[model samples]
Target: MTSTTVRPDLDLTHARWQSGTQGMGDVEIAFIEGYIAMRNGGTPEVPAVIFTPGEWNAFVLGARDGRFDLT
Candidate 1:
């Protein structure tokens, strides 16, 4: 299983709640060398999903190929 982490600090009160947009509309996507992070745009001071870079890339590719279709 891919190791993941959720940021312990972030706020999501004003983020534009979006769905089917990576599972959360209020979230934003970002990444570093070995970690991918999804955080609430409105509340950047609350928790968010963090995944290994590899896993994040895989998900991206899958989404590109219709593998992550929400419908």
Candidate 2:
């Protein structure tokens, strides 16, 4: 993967999100594959997390199941 900075807080609704190395670059999304991608809009050169669709679903499910309880 390419070394990059993070830019979280980016406006996704307005971002022209794209994939690969041929995009606006200003967008805040990068399609990693059929099930995952990178997202970072708080800094411009920090690496971001990549999550598969299934993994994301599991996380949401876990949160709902109290697996992420914080008290």
| Reference-based lDDT, each prediction | 0.62, 0.54
Report the poorest 10 consecutive residues by lDDT, candidate 1.
Answer: 10-19
| lDDT digits (tens) for residues 1-42 of candidate 1 | 895555444343443433344555565766443455677768
Residue 21 accuracy (lDDT) in model 1: 48
Which portions of model 1 miss their true places by more than 4 Å? Answer: 1-26, 42-46
TM-score of model 1 vs. true structure: 0.49
lDDT of 2 at 17: 47
Question: What TM-score does model 2 achieve against the real structure?
Answer: 0.38
